[model samples]
Target: MSDQKTGGFIATAITSIAHFLTEARKQPALSEEAGYGASPNLPKPKPTLIPIMKIAPAVGWPEGKKPTPAKGFAVEAFASKLDHPRWVYELPNGDILVAESNGPARPPANWSFRWWAQDFVMARAGAGRPSADRITLLRDADGDGIAEIKLPFLENLHSPFGMALVGDQLYVANADALVRFPYVDGTTRIDAAPVKVCDLPSGRNHHWTKSLVANKDGSKLYVGVGSNSNVAEYGMEEEVNRAAILEIDRVTGVSRLFAGGLRNPVGVDWNPVSGELWTTVNERDEIGDDLVPDYMTSVKDGAFYGWPYCYFGQIVDERVRPPRPDLVAKSIKPDYALGSHTASLGLCFADDGRLHERFRGGVFIGQHGSWNRNPPSGYRVIFIPFTDGKPSGPPEEVLGDFRSTEGKALGRPVGVIIDKKGGLLVVDDVGDIVWRMRAV
Candidate 1:
């Protein structure tokens, strides 16, 4: 609910505490390893004082815009009129379900509690306003490339994100909770009221919510909770506020902490090869361009990636340092660092047997585009190739030219999934369109 900007006094205070903890935990290295003989791959230490970069708004695309040519794929419109579409899950019957996080009309500039309260009251009074959230079903009935929309399939949701279909049941992650609708073939209506699976903290506009994935056996579900404030606080209570991943039992609804210290893990997927969990995190903001790095990392149990303390793999954040000698020694660094402020969102492993063989087993990430840097970054989809369970190189642009030549953006991609026909389906919130990509 707090609309506090990043880098305010509260954020600075938290940063200071984190820095103190990191420094206090620094240990004296053995003589043999003290010299300039550290591993070559290790990142160099950064200075305490780093410059912060000012972020600019993105350029918007002209009306009726389309994607320019990319090397290996062609884009086709799948569906339109979607309101803030966040996630898309392909069902066994080749249908796709889309979840949208339509919320109270964009909060007023410099929002406050009083303004929000008034808005809520008006909304409840039926002030002739449109609904905030809903979900729908899309299908290509005749094997055509275009998808037809079936509206009102699921209605009256409190801004749901992260959807998955598991054998006769569809699970949705609503703001502050998880719900499931029983599946009935060829029908749009849910068989029964959604059964609550888990309760989470919601209502904050900045980090509303996103990304849910199930384990291979469907026994456990992983849900992402983004940070309440960027690098503001790290206390036990604050840590639980949308900064980690939650693992929940599918049947019992019991949930527990899966991983900690991710600023906003918007993109989460399971590595098909290793069965390990990987996430694309939107790192804390307000630091100069390139200070802290967003990452795609294999999340491990009880691992701490040092939000509000350290970032990327190892650079310590001085603002939030607070002398946690115990945590600094045990914090786990991320495996791969993407560029700062890419706003990475949804992630899925490429599994189709027909696309370029090079992309098989790689990861596809929807970079939602950056809002905290001078020149915006990540307005397209990129591929991270893996070989022998390791990254072969940096991400390559698989889809591009979603932004306008004048710096305006036409569409912002959030979620991605491989369709039944071995093509890729991408959800675009800005243009309210879902695009299907296949080899030409």
Candidate 2:
């Protein structure tokens, strides 16, 4: 089939699936006794409609701007021995919680001579063992600037990604659902059982989950559901394949799709100044280095970003071909393109209120190193400047030199968070450390 025809078919299939799911959930089943006896009664649910909005194309950065170095950011290694730390949340008492994504290894029993030989041979065979996944709370008990480790907050999570603190509650985004626990101040252990807030589709592996954010008032929660496959061309079901952003009511567990056509939005945050939702999306790869551009965009309600059939601020997807001619006029492009394959992971707005005047109202995103390109790109943090709630310039490297001169990386950053004291904490999953950046 032609690219245009394929795009149309995919779009139609996705819409039909979404509609069916929505309608099926709304319908009520008939009770046999009520049907045979008195008047049947059933409450009708409200119809939900997904919104689609148009966004303007992004402008590129000005000429002759050099990338900034990490030294200028005054990065200091704060804590170590973190295995795949995914997200960091700061508490009111100057303590921080770090979520590790790996699973625990089984302890070996007493060794016999034959068992020792077998273990040694197996170790040499290089079998991959599961690592521990736990949440650790760090704080400085003394006046020293360094943070000391506390007891594990929770253990045996299935790849927890993002966390949020609302009042006395701590909500964590686990692989298949949102789990919550009562977070008492100055306590290392959560004595209560975790309550399930929302269940999400997970474990397809192609797109792992990340980044859960709540509105300022904690009324709504947003979760990122990544696409099941790259470009959705593998003929996966629409309910499982299409990339989407989900919004749920905090009081109720009811959730609905907030936006569609976003492939894998790794980092999502609400702009401190504008209160607008912004996301850093990892675009589809393997078509060429620059065919589709990864982006940091202001997500809109019901926005149709051309995924599978369009990309990078309205460039018709050549692989999908012919393109959706109807969508060509309506498809909203990204707000700012952060080069192709930058692998943007974590996003946080600079609310220090003390950054360089030009740095205020901007965002800091951790690019988690890339693998598709020749020279290898994105092993550093970048800045996206905004003015009056819109991006003013292209993404500029604010933290650099994480990658070696030959482009090999010594560390990979996964999530960025601002601590209680207004310092920035970046999680380096590859280096197994968390680095803190503070103003000198």
Candidate 3:
């Protein structure tokens, strides 16, 4: 952007700070109790012009410290001192790729007051850094928890987040589009120019990260695209082909919307037993802290889960003008609630069962945590039990204590995946650490 835009954002940031101080918003009416399991109790919608602002400032962890894992498990820094490590992917050859990135500057977003406020919040949360625009490879050649080899795998990219390998080709999901490059087994670095797969919605990218997953046969790709605005406050036209997952044809490079109204779907994974696609979605905010619950659910093709119009089934959000009852009626309820503003992002299935038996055959969720709710939620990794391919019970905290006693954020969990040794790898964006969890 321009200097004028930057000045305007600064002004808006000041106004947001003043508004937050002046407005004593309503506290959470219900605990996270109403938000969890297969069927959560949806409370009444509490709309507001000013959202509750409670940001946990990001503070780097002290030396020789790490996250606290649950019982029967151990946690250690798999990789550390990286620049904004956001997402991780494990290759078949036991190599791990970490996408060290941040959002790109969008000129259109700089003009909006909402964008200014959000930009201020992200800066406080240590997410306002310039994009590193690269992926680094980490190798635990000795089977130790720590990576023994670190190499610059792929560099000079645009806000890349997700990766998928199909045979000799590797696909990358950037903020604005999808691209592919040829891959060779055991190759440490890729310097080749990528083939442009397709152009994704690249507007004032409020939600920048695009997650990718390939079908079993590697013939198709599933990419998660998030909403352009909080709840279409910038008009519905700006949200076209967003807040959903898209299916891309591998050969033709053509893409189509697979699911809609997901708000901010982040992590995409395939269920081992059910053979179905599942995603963790961050629900809409600005309503009461307890209104709309973030969720994880098995996705169906062409299904709408309600964005600006409704949520958690037919609960309507009155703020959206010219309501679409037709779409709301068709909106499908989610499978499980992850609590409002939890920022649940990373998702992976525990198909290998390397952890304790209690964690076997469940979903591991990396919650990046929240800033909009008082007594903030979601700063660690959680496990949700799944029986017969569906959510069976409430989530259990697998790793936690991301916040200090004074509420300073020590770390936040992001992308999660099982490494070659069946160890769980979690990306800590703010702390610049990748934590490895294994059975003790």
Across 1-440, the per-residue lDDT of candidate 1 in tens digits comes to 35455325544554465445434545532221111111113334343232222222333335667665357678887888776677888878787888866544544563654334334323322221443467788878878778765666788787888887777788898876899988877776664788898787664444667568888889999998887666664344555646789888999998888887888998888787787899988886655444355678899987887776676545567667464545555678777766666777878887645566778888888877665343457788878888766667666778877776666667777798888787788888776778888887
Candidate with the larger TM-score of 1 and 2: 1
| Location of the lowest summed lDDT over 10 successive residues in candidate 3 | 20-29
- Total clashes for model 2: 6
State which candidate has the highest lDDT. Answer: 3
TM-scores for every predicted model: 0.81, 0.74, 0.95
Off by over 4 Å in 2: 1-72, 102-131, 142-145, 236-242, 321-329, 354-358
Let me know the TM-score candidate 1 reaches against the reference structure.
0.81
Task: Tell me how candidate 3 scores on lDDT.
Answer: 0.88
Estimate the overall C-alpha local distance difference test score of candidate 1. Answer: 0.69
lDDT of 3 by residue, 81-172 (tens): 88999999998899999999999986863676677678878987989899999999999888878998988999999999989999999999
Per-residue accuracy of model 2 over 105-133 as CA lDDT, tens digit each: 32354333333332332222221224345
Answer with 2 or 3, whichever has the higher TM-score.
3
